[model samples]
Target: MSAHTTASGSTWAPSSRKPPLRARLLRASWRGLPAKRHDIGWEPGLVVPAADGSPLVTDHYFPRAEGDFPTLLVRSPYGRGLPWSPMYGVLFAEQGFHVVLQSCRGTGGSGGTFHLWRNESSDAQATVAWLREQPWFDGKLGTVGPSYLGYVQWALAREAPPELKAMAVQVGLHDPYALFYEDGALRLDNSLAVGAGMTYQHQGTGPFLRAMLRLRRRVRTAVGTRPLRDGYAPALGGGIPWLDEVLAHPDARDAYWQGADPGEAAARRTVPTSLVTGWHDALVDQAFVQYARLRAAGCETALLVGPWDHTSALQQGWPEVFTESLAWLRAHLCADPSGLRPTDVRIHVGGGQGTWRDLDAWPGQPAVTSWFPASGGYLTRQPPTDSAPLASFRYDPADPTPSVGGPLLSGAAGSRDNTALEAREDVLTFTGPPLSEPVEVVGPVSAHLRVHADTGYADVFTRLCDVDPQGRSVNVCDGLGRLRPQDGRTARLTVPMSATAHRFAAGHRIRWQISGGAHPRYAPHPGTDAARVDATEFTPVRLTLHADSALLLPQGAEDGQEVTAAP
Candidate 1:
């Protein structure tokens, strides 16, 4: 082993070295190896220093009678010991690969401060360089993790390190812009939920700390407070400071986001990647964008999307996520072509029985299906040939529309019932009759709206829902688009809803919801379009939705098969 002094004057060990006994055993316990599985030995707190002299904490598990073997690297800000090391580490190590779970800088027992994803690429490269020098490393490294853990892999893959082999990323964020703020709207609930965790984790774990971190309550307070800046910073305790940094730049065009984008990182990735996410995962849109970019870049990639939200994605999926990932990792990392795995894009269709379907390519080049707004509150296949009437609504920001369901991380997330939400006066509903035949809308859905607002600015929220036999409006996918005063005389709004494989059953009705807001799903548009934006106090804006406004669905669309229209 060799050591070199960093600029910060600490001697950096380039190989696994014994950590203090207390540090090694703290919160780390061993479970007996599974019968007939590889008997693995554990080493906790194997400190690897980053280039800047920050100690990065890592735990390693290896087969008892091991020679040099391939390594599975999982880099995360979450603590590296116990739960993850036991759940993932032992499993991978049992499969004949060494598993190393490392806490990112400033997390667990590591040194320096964790600044979300800012330092992951460099820290990961440094770890790999150190891992290569270790006596047991066989020059092959595969990465796995869900959410933030998975994100670190993408960030590091951009470097194209020689030792890096394969990646299995589940429900990870590639585009910070999309993850944080989508189309100039703050993803209030999700952002604050993550911020709350980052805040509590940064502070030392204690009963008081846990009390302070009562994240759900804090997020509720944050959502209720106005102007966002006033609420999020103070409530989150100024730890995990990047929350404010992201809030500072609400748009993707901001230069602050360029470095963290997965689109840019995709161009540099050379490894075979397995992309797993849920139809309702907040970052599902980013997942599709990432898959397309990787394929266009000619990198070997696989995609699996299911009908699940962020938390549920960890466990639920049609083919089972962990097993599919294991098969993928084994195929690429161990060079074992497991024929049990499907080699095409797979998605679980909603509103139907949970059955997995494989497609040679993604849902590409589907026919454009249009649903136009007609008399009363109905969505029809036939366009209005007569004088088009306008539907009007008053948008009161103080009493904004509430979010009931869909792809959110916090506060009523997932496909929850929206029957009560649709009955609100501020919400405009355009419901279609029962489908005579099942319609499979298996790709991106968009809304084209022609609107004129009496106020300077307004926000448009659109949702696709499946109205079941008992009159339950279950959300499928939704999107929000902000209409600024500078837009034009008549705003032509295009809101791109998330992608989904949903089969509208023969008896189910297709419903489209148009609302002024989705509450903290988006920070309620302050009903203003001034040089200085404010959401605390808002004006009542009269918004008119022209009959030209239409909802666009994917291929295999139905025409002239409508019956009842409900207001």
Candidate 2:
């Protein structure tokens, strides 16, 4: 350790002589982080015993001049190197908290096989037990991390000890089933991406990058395989039995997925928790579910939503995320609330000009507005008087509609120009007239449709897009719903288009896109009752949309005025 003098006239020690320069650079990259209060020391390769007496590799980061600071536990399946080491271990430790960055079982040289969510709860309890025995343990603890790390925090909170004072779950996942399946359809791309990541990410960066590239190159072949379960094997660098198991069990009620969801953890704990997520994150809905559960259980919780996808939330949005997280931890653990925000909900509104807005709670009392899809590809505010068909399209499972953009785990995630996607024959679009004034939507978005499908077994994919004056249609938020045999005889269904806080600029058109499936993003419905993984035959389904269908949006104005659609 080397002692360094700060501009504030205090002497602090860096974990290693070389880390100060790297730490300084890392701190510089993130804008507006609170000033470093102490220097940190890193202890690597400490072995913590798991519930089954297995050795779990862990790293401890502590302030050299610490005086009973709260400890922050970050457990991850990803390797404990690069970003994890400097980001969580060094940064938070420098901010006057001890950070225990540990690798979950079978990852980063930890013992035992990784059984996904099955082992997290026991492992978390064991780690805390170990923490209690440490000489420097102050009995005040907090938990923070992103993605899988966030999931571990939830697992720990399920039976959190009194010492666990605060938690910050950023872009986290609580339900493994929800992460892999949506509306009865398997999220093919997400499953493959997660498969590759969990398998190779812990090995090192190089292997993970190579595996991701390999998956990208072979994704089409994998997605188009005759037996869908066997197709992803090649892309994932040989067979991942767990991936196959996940695909085989699409129903969340299956025994295989039982106990996978730790969502009940939120309702059972009253810890001051801060939730962070992006509007376009793959797990945005899960975050909302967590918020709802916490609120329902009367827990102290806060939410921060940005205009970012899953990965970008940590990259581009780190400044805001870090600031919010640090404040929450400080307020709860250090008994300091000076840096906390006045409101519990903060969101970044996306549009021509992106701006941040704060509210007492999320989706607080927004007015529900309806826009009907009329014939001739027009979206109108008035409902149709006649019960006639508005549009029709044929969906071929062999040539499923390609996904353009929205929440996905891979690099191809986020909003994209949808000019080519809209031109596809398998897709139907209804365009609203240009808006004379900006129409802001700030809550849950849903599309209620009355449709008939030639094949009883089908899927309905709905998307909300913003068509700019330049004719660029970029997806805002979208969702998919699986239709059953009973639905073949004209079904009335509501497709949850997730949620969003977006502003349609003046002159921009609101477009509602309907498609049978978004291939790869979702496993294309085989147009039969058989499970997609077992279906060897494919069928084409003809879908007819009724004009009575409407897109429901929770619209709100900044000035408390009514927002009307253009004539």
Candidate 3:
């Protein structure tokens, strides 16, 4: 080990030993990852001052072999230990790239308070300036990481230097408001999960685990509180002021959210970018939005969507994620196009025994199919002859409808059996008969509902489910919309249920579920003209669905006849 001091007066000791056993084991575990090309060298706890003179803690890793290599910058708020070090620092270094893994302000012993997105852009630029002065920098740069780490990349990309080459964002988040609010309703559970993660994740593994456990155990009581704002602090071990701020603002148009989204960076920059996300990841829609903006800006971009959730994208899907990211970095940053794929978009189709599909672009021209809900709980190609209501359900805030498996931030996310959830009286299910042939839904999914609510203030939760032959209803995609009081008449609402690339197998039946709300997943509608977070009174709401309501799906040809709109 040899110690060297930087201009910032922070010393880092570089080791010339072989890669740690953990890093080697992790590499071996990911069979698809490229073979290691060099021994590893690393320096820990190097201080890089932020633009405002706040010290930012950083760690550097490089290949011991004699060769100039491109540098990959990874900034994270999730601590600089296990998983990150082995995953990014050691592994990428062994692959012949210098990796700089830094801790965000206020976390990992770095100075300055962590105000979420407040200081990221300036800190990122500061790190790059420090990189320019390093003796090992080779002028080529790439950025990679998941979630908040990905956010930092977008922050820097807005004003990136000429040396910045490629970026790979996996299951990343660009808009914090979108992550916490969907259409006007607060995402209670996701907000709480994010609160706990940001508050304790950087402390250490044990503390983070304990905090999560504490959150899990107390979530019920917390969500059940009279005033919704008071419920989460106990579960999180303390009050997270940022989370409180998020809860306070339910409208995305609020000025509080200004400058919070770095999505504009994608539209402005022409950087070659690669995005990875899962169909069930909580930020899957945000990833799609990023890709769309990048492509619209004429930037060279690629997309990889798997069949996993946010965390699973880094766990079970690590091999594929790592492989895709490595290929993108090598192709753009190292000028190695040999490893690049022929297509720009790759998606994992979900159903029985999932399969991968490559396409020139995402969701290339799928036929729009409409299915109408008829009386007797049937979803059919024919329009309803009756003008009467199709179904009705009552939602009680005190006993709000429970959320099932979906794009949640917790461990209980992704596709799970929705058998019990569909059985609730508050939930209405419209099922189509068994498919004569497999129906492939490959693009955006949405619901056009004409509903009448007894209370002006209510919510509509719509979900798409795949019902197997064995009578298992599994969630594929879902969306929630907050309803406001209108004159005592029917209201037409369009609920965007995100997107999916799922195959409803031959034996599977398609089901559309509608309910007043998916409690906890969304903060329950108080059924009164009052803000959900501040509402003290809980009121029950009766919502009736009209026969004219329809489920719109982007589908590919399956059988000879197409499922067209009813005349």
Candidate 4:
């Protein structure tokens, strides 16, 4: 069972007599995928069966590509085989898989418009239907992908593809806007970097992402390493349009984004799933939401949250993630297990330094709770005396607070923004004394406060930071609440910050900053000037962090399950 071979492997032969027209057309369908060439041999070409033209599909088939292997289906947005993702397709090919490198629909050779994650569910379902009929396919399929690609698997899983046996969704998105555009602000930088990387790959950069190799024997340095001159022009063209689309849409509710939301109904089920994540990952919260929701809904799932980011795992080699993944595939698809661990949640914990542990569920159990905040700087049980003046800070749209961390996508995406950028009068900061001891705050951190605007609409955003012993402020988490509380400012509201399991070292302090914008994800209030404006306008006015205003985090727990703190 270990050495698998495709039914059409060496047996595929050209016949002496001319083939029938329908047979020839099926073989040469201008529809499915084109034949591919790989070093091992002529790579099995595309495998799309005739379907409604709407089922645009692109894929690479390996005839016995994996030695005695089950199929490995990777629907990637990043052109497959790019060294950036560590030669994934080529490696799987070497592993004896009838590996299929799908270019999704609008991405590679497949024809269609790219709309992020929404339309992919139907596409994935149709793709499975085609692959199952392939002579080389074993009627079993498993999917793997990261980031946008990971989100694709999630959308597909919602409907539970009949042929889809399992999946490894790495850094996938549960909520598109939450992951990409937070609080209405544009995180232009990181999103651009991702776009650029994918662009470089799509144009077949093998020749150019590697033009430097041509210099080896000559011993002379290449005159230039520019992207265009190196053959990355096509990739650039491919990515630039997508990038432009991102910038043009400032509102999360834009029609363009609605079609890209993977987390909607498409990702609600508990398909047998394995998730990979990290404590430092800006995308960690989304994974947490997915894992918790899916598990609660009764899906057999496994989580491996290492202490890494978007790219670090591939470079450093977390064998556990990969080995366990293959084991999951084997158990579900190939029906094999060579000595695997079965615990559901595998976490690399921080706070008391770092280590690994496994639990049956996430936030696996109960946790401690503490509410810390104030009209001024304080983390006490007592509310600030009403006699004391309420805290106030100015928020100028021209000088809006730049973003930092916590489920971000732009340069100023997820992490805490430069305190220096925010300290410029637009942000209000309250700092407390260093912790008396190591304090583990591991759950959803939230803020409840009273806010006001000179006009009818306003938005309030909150960020939590860990001030080090040296007095530097590092962001931990943040949340946003947009309000049209003006003509009738609503009563005090509690905004929800994303959840996290973090530690405040004995010597570290905590800081809370409240501002008005994160942008592109959460629309910034454009100030109360425009009466007919939506909630995205900025509204300037005095803000009050009521005497009872505070930030609450669930505390120390054996398992990292989430807890909604009650006052």
What is candidate 3's lDDT per residue for 423-532, written digit by digit as tens?
A: 88999999999999999998899999989898767899999999999999999999987666654547888999999989999988999999988878888889887788
Residue 34 CA displacement from its true place in model 1, Å: 11
Model 2 RMSD in Å is: 4.3
**What lDDT does each candidate get?**
0.74, 0.86, 0.86, 0.57
Model 4 C-alpha lDDT per residue in residues 159-254, reported as the tens digit of each score: 776677788877666566655454554343344345554454454666434422332221111111111122222323332565556655657778
How good is model 3 by TM-score? 0.94
Which is better, 1 or 4, measured by TM-score? 1
lDDT of 2: 0.86
Error of 4 at 272 (Å): 0.4
All candidates: CA RMSD (Å): 6.8, 4.3, 4.8, 10.2
- Flag the better candidate by TM-score, 1 or 3: 3
TM, every model: 0.88, 0.94, 0.94, 0.75
lDDT of 1 by residue, 475-553 (tens): 9999998787788636888999878788899999999999888877878777775311235576778777888889999
Candidate 4, residue 393: the lDDT equals: 62
Which is the better candidate, 3 or 4, if ranked by TM-score? 3
Clashing pairs in 2: none
lDDT rank order? 2, 3, 1, 4
In candidate 3, position 547 carries an lDDT of 93
